[model samples]
Each structure stands twice: as structure tokens, then as C-alpha cells.
Target: MTAGQVSNNGPKPLQRNLSRRVSFNEATLARSQEPPKPPAEPEFIDTEAQVVSRPPYSACCNSCCAWTSLVLAVLLLLSILVGGVYFAFLQSNLPQVRLHRLDVYYLEVNNTDTDTFLTSDLEVRLNFTNDNSKIKLSYSRMTASLTAEGVDLGTVTVPAITQEPSSSADVRARTWMRKTSAEEAVAEDLRDNSLKHLMVIDVVLKGHIDFLVNGNKMNGFPIKVSCRSIDQSEIDNGHAPKCGVQMTPL
Candidate 1:
């Protein structure tokens, strides 16, 4: 063929080859830039042979937890039982005190001047009863005071005594009152015509009562005894008066 015709045919084959190579490179670049088709989602299969993961804690840890729970349950049960017993036995039964006999006497009376000191003596016979069938009561010490019209008198002390369950103990104390100004005032008030027929006195007792249960002693609890509005006529007639007692704090 001629030189021009050969050049034309050669260029046509070369151009075709170049066009095919460019198309292939463009397709490859487009596929790469399209995020690689999202990496093809994995297929899910349902089978019995599939594995299940367990918790990180081993069997030993599970056993420890169970034992801890059991111990706590046992402790709670014991606490409830002990509380029930205490309520039924110890808490329900309380001690009582009663005034069995009381007497008052006036001594060294002077209607004239010289301060007119008044002295009095009181005989207090108290019955201490323990109503509990299982617990024993111990009254370690006791001290009592007499008062009239807000004036404090001397104190009376009683020795220690222990009372068995369902038993009673007798407590005897002799209290005296001797004051100068207050005694004169009290005597004057008592001797008044209107009040002479209706005279009253106040008595206060302070002490500690301890409880013994199953060889254990629970003590340090305070007790207060208040005897107020004690009619002198009733005491003179040999009739015991009523009073109230309470458990108090230190």
C-alpha cells in the first residue's frame, strides 16, 4: 500500500487500543471510589450448633454470691427471732412499786419567833413487785426525798435488794425534814385553817433497776418515783396512797 494509507490504518488500530485501555482504567477507578460495594453483608444461619457466650464471672463467683445471700438470710431470721422473744418475754413484763404504808410526825414545834424551825419524820414502806416469771430484778441503790410546797427536805437511803421472779420485796426508809426559812413557811402553809383540813406532801425516789436474764445482766437504767398530792388525812388514817413510777434516762 502507499505510505499515507499505511499511516492511516496504523493510527486507527492504535487509537482503538488506547480507547479500550482508558475505559478499563475508568471502570476500575469508579469501582474503587464507590466504597467497594459496602463489603457484602454476612449471611445469618439458624442452627443448634451455634455457640452462646457466657458471663465473665466463673462458677466460683456464682457460688460465693449464693453463700453470701444465704448467710444474710440466716442472720435476718435470727434477728427476727431474738426480737420476738424479747418482746414476748422481757418487754411485756415490767416491775411495779406500791406504797404500802406512810407516816409523818412533827417534832420540835415553836409557835414563837427564833425562825421557828420545823422537823418532820416520815416512815415509807414500799412494796417492790416483779411480775415477770423468768427475769429477776435487782435494785442496787435507792434514795428518796420529801418536799412540801416546792421546798426540798432531807434524803432517805435504802439498801440494795434483789427480787426473784413473781415475787415481792419490802423496802423501808425513814426520811426527815429540817429547814429554817422553808420549814417555817411550810409549817405556816400547812397550819392554815383552810389547808389544815386538806394537807398534801410530795415524795420523790431515784434509783436504778437491773434485769437478769439467762445469766446476762442489763443494767444502768434509771427509775423515777413520784408521790404527789398525798393527803395528810389519808396517811393519818393508816391508808396507803397511790403513786406513779416510770423508767427514765440517765
Candidate 2:
């Protein structure tokens, strides 16, 4: 009941409430040190965007196809044109050959009952004509043979010659046989009169020719002339028989 006793009156109700509030504030400050939370999600947009591009086809492909078609058409047209030209002009005007004359210098036979021999010298003349008006003709490496009724008497070789367009030329070859088996057989036929005095002879000519067409020269085509069953009497009368000619390709 004195001053000391009043002073000792332990904590009123207000102090007690103030002490509880101070303790709660210290606890809230301790929890504030944790990591911060992430931000909230934003709203979504609803619009879409589109871009325009060029077409896939181009002019180069079309141009290449056009050129290819044009080239093929031109080649086909040229082939048809060349074929027509050859058939109309070049195929019909082939060269011709003739057998002009054959001259025998001497023919002698030596016969003993056991052995027979013969000797002769001869000359042959030929006429060649080129009927082509646009092409020039030439013959090379010429060779010839003389035969009588399947028996080959002799062979001759001649030099090369050139003939102008639409012109004729003459050539000659000389053959001589001395003491040969072929000559002996020919002599036996003459003695036996097996030819019936017709004196039939054959002339064969073989060679290659060159033809110049449109300023271009092409060679190595074969030329063959064959004259058969020619009479000696015709030669003496200054006349000749026609011969056949062929162009054989090699």
C-alpha cells in the first residue's frame, strides 16, 4: 500500500498488449528475406500475317524446248531435199565405155608333134564418154585383160586420165605374149578352126573413178567395162561394138 508497493505492481493490460505486437513485427521482418515471385502471364494476340511469292515456272525452259524442235525440223527437211536432188539428176547420167578396135601385130605358132608354142603382140583401143553435164570424171589405176572364148591371152596396165563434162576421150593398151601357155592354147584353137572363123574376142577393163560434183571430189567408186563376142572382121571394117559399164562401190 505504500510507494514501493505501487511501483512493483507488475505490467498493466496495455503493456502486455504492446509486448505481443512487438514480437509479431519481428517475425514478419524475418520472413521478408525469401526470393521474389515471377511476373504474371500476358494476354494472347489473335492476328495472323501472310506474304506473297512468285510462280515456279520460268521462260528459259520454254525457250530450250522451242529451239530443240526447230533444229530437228530443219534436219529432216534437208534430208528430204538431198534425196530428191540425187534421184532426179545424179543417178541417171552414168559414164559409158566402147570397144573401138583390136590390132594384132603378128601371130605365129611353132608346133612339133610333141611341143607347141605361140607368140603375139596386140593393141586395144577404147572410147570413154561422160554424159554428165555437171560433173567431171577421172579414171585411175586402170588394168585390162584380153580373152578369146574363156582363155585369157594377156593383160595390160594404163595411166590415169581425166575427162571434162559432156566430152569423150580415147585410151589405148598394148599386150604382148611370148612363149606362154595361154598363147599356146589360143594357137591350138586357131589351128583347129574351133572359132568358126568368127575370131571372137573379149575385152575387160577394171579401175576406180573420181567424180567432181558441186566443186567436191569423191573417189574410190569402181568402174568396170566388159565387151564380149567381138569379131576381127569388124575391126578391119573400122567399126566397134557397144560395151556394158557398171559402177560398183567398194
Candidate 3:
């Protein structure tokens, strides 16, 4: 009925509403300042709790599942790409060395009518060249020897005369093994014993190749001249026996 009483009663509803609004605003502000949420709580429905699931999924839940699947797929793809990149990077650092091809030839001599060809006891020619344009050859002496029907004639080093990159030139190397007239007679007798008891000849050669052996270029592939002795009668018939040598190119 009085002025103060009327004023107090008139503002009571507005004051209560204002206070409620202020409390709500304060709660919203506190939520903003709070640390990030600890992710959503997983919903697990007990099978025993009689609950019916519809055929069509809830739209919100379907959208969340789809988003989760997309994120996992992206992560998987990123991991695979990173692994592939790492493998390629590792492969580039590995060493890749190649070898060159080498060829060897054999020449047989039994009887010679010309005296000019009697300079050496036995001569063997060989070739070492790079068939690939990208590869180069690095080697040491070529050691070759002779064998007659599983017999050791001898072994010697093949000297290198010249090397021209244009056409792989022949080294024209020679090997000598001393043989006396008595030795010749014995060899002839042995040959006469059996025609099929043919002689076996082998030439073994090796040298320092481009590859490092124990951290040295002087150690590489071993040379081998394993060939059969050509027919001596062919040489007596006025024809040279075929040279039996192999090629090795680095």
C-alpha cells in the first residue's frame, strides 16, 4: 500500500528473471574457460536390456560414423605413403657395381714349315672389353698356360701391347714352355698309344679388376683359361687349330 512496498513488489519478478539470466550467462562463460572436453562417452547397450534397433540408423549417428571412417582412411593412406617414400630414399644409397665381358681364344700348332712362326713355344690370345657403353674395364696381367691331355704344359703372363677404345684391339700375348726333342718324341709316342686319348688343355688367368678387394682395386676377378688341347694333326695338315678362349668384359 505504501510507496516502498509497491516498488519492491513490482520489481520482484523482473529481479528474479534477471538473476536467472545472469546465472545462466555465468555458467556459459565458465564452460568456455574450462579445459577441452575428454571426448564423447562411448554408448554401450547391454544385450539383456530389451532395446529395439531400427533398420535405418539415426542420421546424426550415421554422420558421425562416416566422418570417423573417413579420418581413419586418410591416416592409413598417409602412413603407406610415408613408408614408400622412406624405402625409395634408402634404395638410392645402395651401391650398384657391374662387370664387363672378356673373351679368350686358343691357337694350336703341331708342325710349322715356316721358321718365322717358331718364335715362341705356345701363344694364346684373349680379349677384355666393355660391351656396355656405360661400363669401363680395369684389370692387371692376364696369366695363361697350356695343358696336353690333362697334362700341365706351363703357364705365363700375357703382356698388353696396346689399348684403343675404337675397336677392342688384340693383346697378342704369348706363353712359352720348354720342350726338347726327347720330350717331343715322348709326346708323339703317347699320342700314338691311343687316338682317342686326346690331350686336354686349360689356361687359367686372373687379375685385379675394377672392384675393390679388401679395399683395394688390385683385387678383383680370377682369370681362368680352361680349354681342351686342339688336334695337333690338324696343324700338320696345313691348317691352324681353332683358338679356344673365353671373353670376359667388365
RMSD of 2: 18.5
Which candidate wins on TM-score? 2
Better candidate by TM-score, 2 or 3: 2
Write out the backbone clash pairs for model 1. none
Q: Candidate 3: lDDT over CA atoms?
A: 0.47
- Report, for every candidate in turn, its global Cα lDDT versus the true structure: 0.71, 0.76, 0.47
* TM-score (all chains, Cα) for each model: 0.56, 0.60, 0.34
Q: Candidate 3 clash total?
A: 24
State each candidate's clash count: 0, 0, 24
lDDT by residue (1-250, candidate 3, tens digit) is: 8999998799889999999999999999999999997989889878655445445578998999999999999999999999789555333321222111121222222443422111124454444443333323444666666555554556666653323222253444445544322244445544452243333334455443343223433234333334345444433344433333232332
- Candidate 2 stretches with Cα past 4 Å from truth are 1-91, 182-186, 191-197
Query: How well does candidate 1 score on lDDT at residue 116?
Result: 68
lDDT: which candidate is best?
Answer: 2
Considering TM-score, where higher is better, how would the candidates rank from best to worst? 2, 1, 3
lDDT of 1 by residue, 8-48 (tens): 78888889999999999999998888854557778876554
The ten-residue window of minimal lDDT in model 3 covers 94-103
